[model samples]
Target: MNKQWFVVYCKSREESRAQLHLQNQGIHSFFPKIRKEKIIRGKRSTVEEALFPSYLFIFVDQEYTNFSKIRSTRGINDFVKFGREIARVSEETIKRLENACHSINDLKADTQSLFKSGDKVEIKSGSFKGLSAIFEAQDGLERSMLLLNILNQENKISFCNKEIKKAES
Candidate 1:
């Protein structure tokens, strides 16, 4: 049987733990993660979070691997399935995900901004509360540049991501 990639559903916040258990059992698994900047209590910090929370990928030959053992692995819930058929991911898809993870990891930690240029956003706090703006660029880890229209003039302003949110379409 050819080895194929399959999706595994893991216990909440247990993706890393499940991957470790699978590795210990000689089962190869892939858990993609990305670095992100987050603000907590006015402090900026970098965090590595799972790209697909509570899920991971495993490579195995279904005909030879012990499905029962895999399903019962510590920190693992079960294989993702639709009805009775197990979910399978193509090798190309896995490769693409791997490449994307690598590219993101290679970029500077603060470069992982949530909004892009021309993105519609709303100021949720501060003096600009109840106003809409267009995201211009990320100033730093916590501050972002936005284009706001006020008094019949287009003004560029900076605000924290915490104070801005994507405008509802």
Candidate 2:
């Protein structure tokens, strides 16, 4: 059977439960999780929770007509859809999800904060050295920036993620 990654929709807030059900039925399933800290009752605690709260992935025979059997299970919501058909996620996407499940580091939310408004900064490296670009916003950590081009300056380029450093007084 050619195995393909398919997104399965679990009942609202029941991803883990559905994964367990699939396991009991001898089907392969995966539910990605991440550890995050939250303040509960004014106390900080870490919890390992589903990275995607209502979804999991499964591998099954493409020609299997048993999709309805899975869909009718108690905790299963549905297979993810593309209009009238189930959507197939790429193998690469599924591998990424698997990596997240086995990682020990804290899950990172995409919230890189770089340069801000009204901030005075200098480009520490790259072709724009000595020319100060106004600190704009975080461009993924190592590089943060401001637009060097005024209007007609098409030659100005966006800085690389590793090309920026904050200017000092």
Candidate 3:
């Protein structure tokens, strides 16, 4: 059976526990995380945590048998719902989201925000890593941008449609 990505709604504050329980049940899963800054009692701190709290992704053969077992598990709130049905994410969407979480872990402070105008930039990571440039313009509302790089004695190249942001100086 082909496995599809399904969203799971873990109990409030029990996402990790649910993940563990599902793992023990031989289910493959993933919970994408990000580092968030919080102030608790006048102290600021950064924490590595889930991007979507109480939500986890599971890859499984979607069947009533599997669904029933999942619903019976401790710490499971419910399957993420869309209308009257469980919401399933496309493999591409899940893959990109997973990449964003992982990528952010290695990100520098200056580059945290997605591409912005007038920011010094570079593709320090991903398929286009090591390409350095300056963000002079954006292509659309999705934060994608066009960048200019100087190479080979003042020659300039413009990335027509690129997803890049400010790079750490």
Candidate 4:
């Protein structure tokens, strides 16, 4: 039987624990994580978090691997499924994820803002799509404030990081 990758749904914040238990059972598993800066009790800290919370991948040949044992593994809830069938991940997808994980892990913590104040940016989506604006400041990890000129008045507006991009000079 050919081996394939399958996703397992784990209890909240238990992906690492599940991965460990799977390894102890001699099962191959992949848990992708990323380093991020977060504020803990008002103090800045660097932490590693699962790229996909509550999920991890396992390599198994269904015919040989004990399904019951895997489902009963510590911290694992069950295999992800589509209705009555277990979900399978493609080898190419796993390879891409592994490559991305390596690149993410190799990156050094950058303190510099992605967009400096006064930098020009363009709204990529939402009602303001295609509009150019001036970057004001980062609102949070996933948001930013921009100065949009409308009717000869500059208005401050908030947008998600994905909704804005650096405008070509």
- The best candidate by TM-score is 1
Question: Which residue pairs collide, candidate 2?
Answer: 114-138
Error (Å) of candidate 1 at residue 56 is 0.8
RMSD to native for every prediction?
A: 8.4, 9.9, 11.1, 5.5
The TM-score of predicted model 4 comes to 0.64
Put down candidate 2 lDDT per residue, 1-169, tens digits, no spaces. Answer: 7878788888888887888888887789888887665766875456778888888888888887489888977799889998998988888988877776666434342225544565655666666777666655654323344767456572334564445555676
In model 1, state the lDDT of residue 45: 69
User: What RMSD value applies to candidate 3?
Assistant: 11.1
- Please give the range of 10 consecutive residues that has the lowest summed lDDT in model 4: 105-114
| Residue-level lDDT tens digits of model 4 in 1-169 | 7999999999999999999999999999999998786878985566899999999999999999999899999999999999999999999999999999999777652213568889999998999999999998866555678999999999999786768888998
If both were scored by lDDT, which would come out higher, candidate 3 or candidate 4? 4
- Of the two candidates 3 and 4, the one with more favorable TM-score, higher being better, is 4
lDDT score, candidate 2:
0.70
Candidate lDDT (C-alpha), each? 0.89, 0.70, 0.71, 0.88
Q: Higher-TM-score candidate among 1 and 3?
A: 1
Whole-model lDDT, candidate 1? Answer: 0.89
**Order the candidates by TM-score, highest first — what do you get?**
1, 4, 3, 2
All candidates in order of lDDT, best leading: 1, 4, 3, 2
lDDT of 3 by residue, 96-143 (tens): 998888787756343225556667777645656677676755432223
Sliding window of 10 residues with minimal summed lDDT for model 1: 106-115
C-alpha displacement of 139 in model 3, angstroms?
36
Residue clash pairs of candidate 3: none
